[model samples]
Target: MSLPALSPYHLSLALTLPGLLLLWRNLRFRFYASRRARKIPHAQERVLILGASSGVGRSVAHVYVKRGAKVCIVGRRRDKLDDVARECRAMARGGAQVLMVKADCADPEEMVSLRERLEEEWQGLDTVIITAGVSALRPMMSNAGVEMDPRHPPKSQATAEGLTHAISVSNAAITGNFTGPLVSALSLIPLLTLTSRSPSILLLSSAAAVIPAPTRALYAATKAASLLLYQALAIEHPQIAFTFFLAGTIEGDFRASAVDKALPPNLTSSGSGSDSSEPTPLVREANPAKHGLKVGWVAQRCAQAVDRGEKNVFTPMYMRFGHLFYWIVPAYVEWRARVKYRYT
Candidate 1:
């Protein structure tokens, strides 16, 4: 039924609204899919994790262990990695091998070493989940050392191998996490059994990435750059999915020591850190892997997303809307976040 001829503005709105609606619905469906998959059983596969000793990485290790996936734990903390491996062994169904390889994520050579080690044992790697990352929360304004510089920053840090930790992690997501993982899963593609032809590279970006935080310049820049790269990669490869998980304000141990000491009671309800009202010591949210996202929760949802072969995931729900807000009301968002977090 033809009603009336639409103006350019009307046509624009009409075209735009539906597209926005479709995107909203699609994201909503995936979110629900992730929620539902939480209820089902996890399918087992061999897994390797970086920064496997603590936080979300460790939690993911625990989740996979329960599912009978043999896990290889990698981190600088040999003892902690060993402990996690021992625990996984006790919980194994098929009795998974927990190879504790001590390598620094900041050092590319160390990472290369770890890869070589993997090659030595396994014919091929099934999955590699990298949760190894570090952050400095000293508002990035001052070169205040929130995190001490290790004499030798691991492969996760800027390694002697000429790769910055940011580059290794983000660029790795582009090549290995997204593209490489898909090709590796080719065997399962025929069955669409273990995982669909739809391979996925799930990355942990931040809410600060979308909405620029003053002190998080480098961290945000790196994450933003990687996020865009994923979009391009996804466009080029439709069959393989590129998933970026934009994690939001999760209170965890990784907050800068001084900031952690200043959080108010309401913010630090658990009595772990200080409140926002206090003077912020550091700026960029340290050891993002340490806190912010619930380790077990993220692990569970990650498994769910892996199982469903979903494309993208932005957690805490606010992030989906945030993508819109950051575009439309960026200044206000920045102002509020600064005031709210009380960045000096």
Candidate 2:
């Protein structure tokens, strides 16, 4: 059976509809942006940023510091936190306070103590930005060949060791990417709800959460968990504003500290080195000439999204189409992802 070809009217409609929809979306975004710009400035607002010692967290701290916000930066490394605090203070406007705290976001007791400290010092909290997450660049089945039988797993010494290492790496990703942010949010939401009129929480998520990609199974799963956690929180708390910043690849050394120990060091720009109490060089340095978006620009966009109370923000703008594209063409998306991530 032969089918009739599409008419010119149908082809024209197919081409024109997308353009009209895009124009409508742009207008709507501009309308909301203008409204948000007129809101109260961040001057004197209390903000707490987790994982602020490096990467996007540090950049976000700079953004809020310039806006004259009382910023508290938290991270496990005290030396790095101090360096960030110093930078924030230097950039502070209108006496913006920069407090550096050494703590792990996955620790409940530490989060409690942090909440108490904020209450004591700042009286309340207005914003909380969570950017503490580890990256994974290895496939999920990288070590599966060592122990194929689930019923008789870890039969040999080599297999046992391999499995143990793989599990540890997976645990690190979950703890850093999901559990840590969940703990921090649970501890701080109460204070935010009680204190601020327009409480905001910005989560530095990744586009991988929605778009599947090779070598990103663990990373995407954990990030998706965190994203959904915040989305649920948004539904439960109507007064608080939540912004999930789903960013694409940024020009930085973030891969240096990936949880996947099996990944070759050469694949990353540089190694962060072993953990030390002393002040060591920062791992996540930004390179403007590198591929992808700039860290500073992404940070500014995150801040703007929080101010506007936007539910989801996709950087590079075009990343918003990724989900739809993947839905329409799964094989092509998978192939592109493999090529981009350098996975076979």
Q: For every model shown, what is its TM-score relative to the native structure? A: 0.62, 0.81
lDDT of 1 by residue, 1-344 (tens): 98899999999998899999989877876875564345332343556676677767777788887876657787778887878888877876665566778866655566666666666765335555656555434332122212222132222221232223333433433442233323322322222223322234455556666767765655565556656665675677565444566777655553431221222222211211222223334543344456466667887877666555555677877777867887888887777666655553
- The TM-score that candidate 2 achieves is 0.81
Show model 2 residue runs off by greater than 4 Å.
1-40, 143-158, 262-289
RMSD of each: 11.2, 7.5
The model with the greatest TM-score is 2
| RMSD after Cα superposition, model 2 | 7.5
TM-score, model 1 to reference? 0.62
259: Cα error in model 1, Å: 14
Tell me how far the alpha carbon of residue 258 in candidate 1 is from the true structure, in angstroms, after superposition: 11
What lDDT tens digits, residue by residue, belong to model 2 across residues 112-137? 99999999999999889999888886
